[model samples]
Structure formats: C-alpha cells, structure tokens
Target chain A: MHSPGDKDNGEIEALIQMMSRLPGLGPRSARRIVLHLIRRRAGQMAQLATLLASVAESSRECLACGNVTQSDICPICQDPSRATGEICVVTDVADLWALERGRAFRGRYHVLGGSLSALDEIGPEDLRIPELINRITDENVTEVILALSATVEGQTTAHYIADALAPTQVAITGLAQGVPIGGELDYLDDGTITAALRARRKF
Target chain B: MHSPGDKDNGEIEALIQMMSRLPGLGPRSARRIVLHLIRRRAGQMAQLATLLASVAESSRECLACGNVTQSDICPICQDPSRATGEICVVTDVADLWALERGRAFRGRYHVLGGSLSALDEIGPEDLRIPELINRITDENVTEVILALSATVEGQTTAHYIADALAPTQVAITGLAQGVPIGGELDYLDDGTITAALRARRKF
Candidate 1:
C-alpha cells in the first residue's frame, strides 16, 4: 500500500527518480524541481513535456560527423560556407558546441564521441576516427586541427588520429597550449606553466 | 537563417531554457542535461517526457490541507487512521514532506503555502490560514503544532495563528528551537546557541 504522507503516487516518484539521474541533480534538487514543475503544470511544465517529447522523437546523431541533429546530415555538414578545408576534431558534441560558441573557427567539426581509453578497451573503431579520415580525402580537407583536451587519453587519441591521417599528407596541427586569458600564474600547474614558457612568442 | 554549428533546432534550445529555469540548475547544467537526454532519447528522455505529461494532467491541490495530490483530497487527509486530532501546520509542502520523512509525526498536515510577511504585504487570506482555522473545528482537532521556521515571518505567522485560534479553547504550540542534531557549537550562530541554551533539558 502507498503511504499517505509520502509522494502521491508512483508517477511522481518515478518522475523524481528520472530527474535525479540527470548529470548534476541529486535527490533533494530533483524533489524541488518536481514540486516546481507540479506548481506550474499549466504553463512551464506543459511546455517542457511537449518539448522533451518532440526533441526525443526527432533528435539523432549526424551521419557525417557524429554530432547530434534532427536529421541524418547536420546543418554544419550540409552548409557550403562551413566547408572550409579545416576540420577541427573534438572528443564530443559538447566541445564542438563550446568552440562554436567562441565563434572563432569557421570550418566544420568532427566529434570523436570519446577519447581513446585503454582502460575501457575503447579503440579507434569505437570512435568516429575512420569517418574523420574518410572526410579528409572526400572533402579535400587541408588541416585537421586536434582540438582535443589536455588529458593523457585526449593526447593519445590526437596522436593516433595524426598517425592515421599521415598517409593523407594533410597539414595537421594542435591547439596552442598556454595560460588561459584571465589565468593567474600563481594558480598555474607545472605542466601548463612549462608549456606556456616554452611556446612563448615575441610579445 | 539558423546557424550551422549552434544547437540543431529551436526544440533543443527551448528544452535547455526550460531545464535551466528549474531550481538548482543553471544554463551550463541545463545544456548538459539536454545533451544527455537527446543521447538517450529512446529510453530515459522518452520516459521523462511521458511522466511529466501524465503527472501534469493528473496532479491537483488537496482541497482540505493544500497538499499536492492527484485527487480532491490528499491521501493523508483521506486516511481515517491519521485522524489523530493533531494538525501539524507547516509553511510549505516541502516542510511537510521533510516531517513525513522523519516518520515522527502521525497526524495530518496543514500547509500554509507561505509564511506571513508584512514587507511582502501577505495577509492571512493570502495563505491557507482560514482553511487551517476551519480544520480545527471541523476535524475535532485538539493540538495545532506550528512546525514553521524560526525566521521573523515564520514567528509572526505562528503568533497570528495562535491568536486566531485562542477563542476556540484549542491548545496551540510551536516547534522547540535548538541546535540541530550533529551540529557543531563552533559553527552554530549565536542566536541558535542562545536558543539551544534556553531550551536545555535533562539527559
């Protein structure tokens, strides 16, 4: 039998459970969010439900670059203007979106989905590395910028991609390592400081 | 024209905005949650959408005590076994839920929705104060425990309720203020320490 003073029914309990599974939310925050949604069911909650349903039904991985899209070919891959010879490769769609937010890179992106992890037994075939290589020849790509993270796995994936695409004779480069725009030298890690000093330009 | 590298469509963007509006979630966490949902669209995302829709359609405020329920009266108000003649008055449903979780309160609850605030121009009519007063006579309630916060507004509301029910000859009480369980004396505020000292009891 369901308790009287606890949650109303299984539906509410199930909703809270699902919400708590989200990346940053916990049980407490999930309960608060559920209550907030319940109070605004006629307006914000209804809209959110409709949007979630539609987005779930329509969203898919872009066939070209593994980025999420509502269609087989994402807008970036279909756009002629974004077909610059440079393909900035990233580890996930989030990185692609982050670079897009910066609005610096005019070329398209290749989302690898994840880094090369020997611990997890993840290999090149698991990621979109092969598809990235195919694009180099098919799209007449000039540069393959490795915009991967500074982690060991990220560097390993970058090296593996560079080696895989060496036969294509494409101009491959990695993002410059240095202090962040507002970073303090006192808070800098040893590796970042070393990289910044070694790559220091005539300022 | 829609940007190529930004979010795929307005649905995803709208979903992110709605998620961000949730308590404890910001824009960055919302984006992360949206991406997570999109990736698991066939399973978790679809389930959440369906649950949200069903819950929104079914939920309503309990007619008696103002607790959230799927019917006219909440299960707590409906249960005859819970008619202990003690109505625990709380400032919000969240507090009621908290007390219920402790499993210490055996009686029904009266949710005031909010505490009285003179600055906010909220009066007795603004909350469920009148309904709470009616429950005292209608339910043969003996003790009305004001499980409200220790804030100025909470104390003012408690005092007003006590005065309102004074003519009825019903017993009224407030929650004892003290240092919380597992609280350290050094970290506690002066007001809490003073209250705890005044409420000292024999071990």
Candidate 2:
C-alpha cells in the first residue's frame, strides 16, 4: 500500500527529469537541486515557488528591445538616464545581465533573441533587427553597440546589423576582439567585463 | 499603451527575485537563469515548471529518517537492498548527495534535518535523533556512520546522537577530521571525497 508522502514520487520523478533539462545540469544534478529546494522550503524554496509561479505567468519578451522584462520595456530601456543615444545589442539576456553586473555601461541594451542560425533557418527577421532599426530613430539613439558573441555567426550577425543600419548615420561599435567574450560569461570576473565594456570600439 | 506581450511583468519579476535567492546566485544571475529557462520553454522550462508545481505540492519530511522525500518512508528506507543493518546519518540531503556522488557508501542514510542549535532552540526532538535510535535495533543496524560536518554544532550533534545510541550494541563511527565541507559548491574532485570517506574514524 502506498503512503501519503509516497503519492508524490511520480511528481518528484517528473520534476527531476524536468530539472535535468537545465543547462549544465543532468538528471542527477536535477534530483539534487530539487531535493535541496524541498529541504529549504520555508526560507529559500517557498520564495522560489512563489517567484516561479508568478514568473511562469508574467514573463514575456520586451516588445521594443526583446529583453526579458516584467513590463513592455526592460528597466534599462525604461530608465531615462540610460537613453544616452546608445543601444548595446547582445545575443541573449545572459550577456545583458553580465553587462549589468559590471555596472560600467551607461547606455541601454537591445537583445537579439538569438544569433543568425543558418542550420536552424534563423535570419534577421528571427531576431530584433527590424525593431532595432525602428528604435534608433524613434528614440534618438545616436550609437548602436554590437555586443554580440565572438562566434562566426555572432560576427556575421554583427556585420549584417552594421550593414543594415549603414543608412541610419549611427556610430556603430562592437566589443573589442582582444577581450575574449562569446560563450563563457560565468567564468569571467566582474572587472574583466568592465574592462571589455570600457574598451569597446566602432564596428 | 499596451504592447502585445506586455502582460507578464509581475511573474517575471517574481521569478527574478526567486532566482536571486539561490546560493552563489544574485539578482542578475536569477534574471539570467529565468531568461535562459524561458527561451528553452518547450524542452526545458515547461518540464521545469511542471516538476516544480508537482514537487511543490507533494514534498514532505521522511518520517523515519528526516530526509526530504515524497513519502513517509523514503526510498532509502524502503529499498530492501539498503537493509544492510547500517545507517549513515548526515546533516542534510546535500551531504547524502555528496556521498552518493562518490558512489562509495553502500548502506542507507538518515538525514538529521539539521544540527542541534542551542541558539536556534533546536533539541533532540527537533531532529530525527529518537527515530534514529529506534531504527538501531529494528533494522538490526551493525554500524552508524556519523557523516556530519566538523563544525562545533555538528560535532555536538554527533556526540548527542552517539550518546543517545549508546544503549544499543551497534558500532558508531564518524567522518574523519581535517576534511571540511559546507555543501557550497558540491564539485570536489571525487578522489577527495572518496579519500575523506575512506579516512573516516570512530567517534
């Protein structure tokens, strides 16, 4: 006969499998993370649960810049001080968060949902290219920073964006090539990000 | 006014806050984690959500051992293969995970929920001490491995459990000294944990 607590084994098993899908996390790690969360429920787990429920309901892509935001515009775009006529474009929200952690950049950001995926049929339309063009004139953006990944696709995308915005007369720039930042963000110290941001140059 | 996808800010904010609460993670990291999860919704986030929802609904305390599981009797307790007449008591599930990661221990584990905290008003009843004592003879346990931290509270709790189990004839042992673990990273080289496990001494 199954007991009261045993009833949730199926649920826990499903949860473990789901957690296993996370990046850098496998089924074993997923089970461990879930167990840890459950054990600390009153403090960390409860708060996480409420947040997960709410975010699962409220999270959406920003209409203008494509940043993950709770509102139509991300905090960076909404902030008046950040509208210094500069829009730093990045591949994903993780890169945006890395920039934010450095706290060195004063301008805003435009997240390009993803890089141009040739094998995956991802093109400019698949990204925020059009929205970025519209935002330039609409918001008096004087400069566009191509803070994309250093991968082949990232560079191709950067060149594509630079060419697309060629007529806009905007001061286009990209993060420095010597700084080494594309796939790995968690490993870089805060100061390295700050340095890279400081040394960004025209694309 | 209202953008097409501007409806879910509240949920996103809640998720960001929850992610921030994780150890070694902050607001920025949480935002990134949420965004990463969202982008992979089909294969990752959806599964994670379902798992979280179900685990949130069904998780409970392991009545006999204090391990957080989905049943009154945990898998370790119910497993006939684990009926080796030995129980390795620990402070939390993380320790158990650490032990499992090593693939060293063959017997079952009894999590203590937490160490006895005088400052926190935690006594023997607050932990699974009495339950652990009851399992000694009932399970015909030959040894009790006190796989607890080397902290003052951990040592004290170990001593208390050892003292409580004194009436029984089971051999009581503990994890060795000079090896420290706070369950912060959980990424120690397997050999280190294995060495520590092998070097374990009597309490």
Candidate 3:
C-alpha cells in the first residue's frame, strides 16, 4: 500500500525530480529552488513558468547556421552587418552565445551542434557539418575559424572539417593556444604550458 | 540603435534572466540549462514546464502544520498511523523532508516556516509559534522535538518555544549533537568536533 504522505505529495516530488535532472542541480539544490519558487509563487514562480513555456514554444535552431533563435533564421545569420565573409565554427550554441558576448568578432557563426564522436556513434551527419560546408559555398564565406575545444575529439572533428573544406580553399584557423586570462602558469598542466610556450608571441 | 543580435533575441534573454534568478543557478548555468531544455523540447522541457505550472497551481501550505500539500491538511497530519501525540518542530519544510527520509521519527511535524532572527526582524508572530502552542492543547501533544539547526537563531527560537510550552509540562528535546555517519574527524570543524566530544556516548 502507498504511504499517505507519498500518495498525496506526488506532484511536488515529481517537480523536484524534474528540476534535479537539470544541469548543475542535484536533489538538495532542487528542493531549495522548489521551496524558494513556491514561496515566491505570485512573482518569480509564475514568471518562470511563463518564460519556460514561451521559450520552449519559440526557441528553435536557426535553419541556416544552427544557432538558437525564436524565428526561422537566427539574428546573426539574417543581419547584413555580420556578413564579413568569416564564419566562426563552434561545437555548440553556447559557444556561439559566448562569442557574441565577447563582441570581438563581427562575423557570423556556424554551430556544429556537437563534436564527432566515434564511441557514441555520432558522425558528420549527426551534427550540422554538411550544412556548414554547404553554407561556405552558398553564402560565399571567405574564412572559417574553428573555435572548437582543444580536446582530442575536438581536434579530430576540426581535422575532418579542414580536409573537407580544403577543396573550397577557405582559410581555416583554430583558436590560439595560450595561458587564459588570469590563469597562473604554475597552476597550468604540463601540456598547456608546453603549448603556450610553443605558441608564445613576441611582445 | 539596438544590436541586430540583441533585438530579436529578447525572449531567450528574458528566459535566461528569470532562470538565473533561481537559487543555485547563475547566468552561465542558466544559459546552459535553457539551451539544454530547448534542445530537449519534445520531451524533458515540455514535461518540466507542465509540472511547474501544475505544481504552482495546486501546491498549498497545510492548514494544520504549514507543510506543502495539494489538500487543506497535509498527509502526515491526516494519517491515522501518525497520531502518536508527538510533534517534531522544524525551521523549514526541507528539514521536515530530511527527517521523514530517515524514517526514525514516526510522529507528525510542525513547520515553523523559518527561525526567529532579530537582525532580520523576524519575531515569534512571524512564524507559526502561536499555532504550535494551540496545537499542544488541541491535539493533546505529549512531546515536542526541536529539530532546528544548530545556528544561533535556531537555538534562540528553540529556547523561546521551550519557555512558551513550559506551562503545558510536555517533554521537550533537541536533535543530539554528534559526528555524522561517514564523517571523518580530521575534516570536521572545531565546533562540531567539540560538540561531538562533549556528547560522546560510552559505547
């Protein structure tokens, strides 16, 4: 037989379970956030629910560049001002967002959706790699900057894309390897230190 | 003039802002969660939105003990098996949930909503202290367990309640101070170690 407490309080428990599944939230933090939301029911909770629904309904991958957008085409892909003939290729939309936040790159972006993973059985078609190559020719892209992570899988995907785009003869570059801003050399791993030393520029 | 990217993406930005306001989530993590949700729109995202809306509409504080419930009275208070004439007083519903998870305490609970804080100007009347005293006589409560935190405000609230319930001559108790299971002595702070030492059992 179901316990009285368990039977009657299933909704709250279910909400907690769903929230706990979100990235960066565990069971303890989920409980705290749920209670906090419930207490602010009139304001934050209602606002959050509305936002979640609207975002879920409206948010979609940009048909052209694979960036998230509320419309058919993401802002960057549609904006004439961003057409600098340079496409920054990133592994995910989050990276695209990060590049936008930096405000340093005036060019557009191509989100790969994810890196190629053989172990996970993910291939070029699994991501937006074919779409990216198609965009280079159709959009008359002059350069492609590979802003992928420096992991082994990231390198493998970058190399595959580079070979594919070699026929197009577009200038492809990866992000510079170096000590990050505010990163101490002593705390950095041997591999990073070596990469940084090799790629060191003259002041 | 609005930036091309910023103007069209207001809804996504608003969603991120609201998500960032949630406890334990910052702007970066909020963006990550939002992106993840958007990607999982067909399943987890829609499910979470539905649950949030339903929980917001249905969940209400129990009229008796202030526990969150779909009904007027919470399950613990309504359960015939829980009428043990003993009440566990907790500073928050999370604590009540934790105690219930232990299953060591079979009695019902009284949620104070929060501890009294002089600096924050939270008084006895701000909590459910008055209702608790009334419950003692109305429910024929035999014992009151103060399962509040070991913070100063928690102790002050416990002492105040102890004094208030003295006239009824009911047995009062607090959670024992001790080294938690799987807790290492080296990792424990001075205060916890001291408390554990003082309350050491002759095992």
Could you give candidate 1's per-residue lDDT for residues A87-170 as a string of tens digits? 988888887776666556778899999989999999999998989999999999988888777677887998899889989999
Q: Residue A188 CA error for candidate 1 (Å)?
A: 14
- All-Cα superposition RMSD per candidate: 6.0, 5.3, 5.9
The residue-by-residue lDDT of candidate 3 on A37-124, one tens digit each, is 8887767787788878888888898888888898888878778888899888888887777666655677889889888999999999
- Which candidate, 1 or 3, has the higher DockQ? 1
- The CAPRI quality class of candidate 1 comes to acceptable
lDDT of 2 by residue, B29-126 (tens): 56656777777645566556656755666678777776667767777667667778879998887777677778778788998878899999999998
- Chain B alone, TM-score, model 3: 0.84
What lDDT does candidate 3 reach at residue B101? 60
Model 1 chain A lDDT-worst window of ten: A194-203
Worst 10 residues of 3 chain A by lDDT: A194-203
Provide per-model DockQ scores. 0.48, 0.26, 0.46
List ranges where model 1 is wrong by over 4 Å.
Answer: A1-8, A179-203, B1-8, B179-203
Docking class of 2: acceptable
TM-score of every prediction relative to native: 0.86, 0.72, 0.85
Q: Candidate 1 or 2, higher TM-score?
A: 1
CA deviation > 4 Å runs, candidate 2? A1-21, A24-33, A72-87, A97-109, A116-122, A134-143, A149-155, A168-203, B1-14, B80-84, B98-108, B116-123, B137-145, B149-159, B170-203
* Residue B30 displacement (Å), model 2: 3.1
